[model samples]
Target: MPADKKPNSRTAMQPDDASRILVTAIEVGDIETIVALYEPDAILFSKSGRAMQGAEAIRQDNLGLIALKPTFTIDFITATVSADGQLATNRMKADLAWTDKEGKEKRGSVDTLEVLRRQADGSWRYVIDDPYGSMRANLERR
Candidate 1:
């Protein structure tokens, strides 16, 4: 689907649905869809150890990722919704494939933690996304 194409409005998005949609958007290099999945004040903990806040910053960071033409799969380990159903958290394991700046294809795995908030319209959007959430612990164990 084109980046400009909005998600289907008929189904209300759950935390898992939001994650799946994000994976699809990234695979298709759909920057618009990716940004739409986040709340206006969302924050992303980038791999470079910087926090990217708001839609514009997130968009700028993702542009670099999208330029890599990455292909990836997200295996959600867990999703827990708050009692009020307005907030949720998810743990995921992802396998990614992309071409590096050196013009070589690379594959890697990552652990991610994501926080989502329910929108007024019943859709869920990401409030915080940390792609390297588990990297430090994993590296320490090795």
Candidate 2:
């Protein structure tokens, strides 16, 4: 999808639907579809733990991944909806495969955490996406 083009009208009526749409968009390199899945001020945490916020930043970040022509399989762990039914949290593991610049296939997996909010239109969109959310990083005690 072109950067200047309008995003797709796909709506995530269920939390898991959002995950399905996301993985499909990524696999197909549909930037507009991927961007449309996020809220305007959404935040996305990269594999390196760098944070990219807002639509533009998120768009740019995903563009890099799209360039890799990656494919993914998402295994959903859990999804918890708030009592008010307006917010949800999701945890999943994404197995990724892509070809590097040298044309060698690479494979890896990452744990993801996503926060989704129900829009007034009754659809869900991601507000926070952390690709490495489940990783236990090394930390030093003070």
Local distance difference test values of all predictions, in order: 0.79, 0.81
Cα lDDT for residue 42, candidate 1? 97
TM agreement with the true structure for every prediction = 0.84, 0.86
**Superposition error at 98 for model 1 (Å):** 0.9
For model 2, the local distance difference test gives 0.81
Q: What is the lDDT of residue 66 in candidate 1?
A: 79
lDDT of 1: 0.79
RMSD per candidate (Å) reads 3.2, 4.2
Sum up the clashes in candidate 1: 0
Deviating ranges (above 4 Å) for candidate 2: 1-9, 136-142
